[model samples]
Target: MAHLIFSEDEQRELREAARAEFPGNPALAYVLENLAAEGIDLDRGRDWEDLRVEAGLPERNAEAPEVA
Candidate 1:
């Protein structure tokens, strides 16, 4: 199989589409794994939050809350 390359804008669009269409589905995770395999660090910088909000998901804290 040939490897596919995506431009930054295309990547952003893909992320948005995946998140919006599969917010609660494993497909979203699949999309992100594929992107990671292509060297896109989705967890880096503000990409995570930006993508989630852009996809109409609620904003969430990056770090987990402390347990009592």
Candidate 2:
């Protein structure tokens, strides 16, 4: 599976779109379901980096320059 990384602006836009399309905890339901399917329990207290690594997703490098 190819993972597409999004910049902050793109992420914000996508989130706003989701909210407009589906009201009331729209993304939360999907996120929780997928995480459960992946055997990721939020109660385990996993950090953001841990979640990304577990999900086989890429993490943005803070020191790296953004591609234009």
lDDT of 1 by residue, 38-63 (tens): 75544454666678778997555568
lDDT by residue (1-68, candidate 2, tens digit) is 23345555665665566556657886675664443334434455658788879999777889867766
Cα lDDT, model 1, residue 59: 52
Which 10 consecutive residues of model 2 have the lowest summed lDDT?
A: 32-41
> Residue 33 deviation, candidate 2, in Å?
13
Please report the candidate that would top lDDT against the real structure.
1
Off by over 4 Å in 1: 30-33, 36-68
Per-residue error at 42 for model 1, in Å?
22
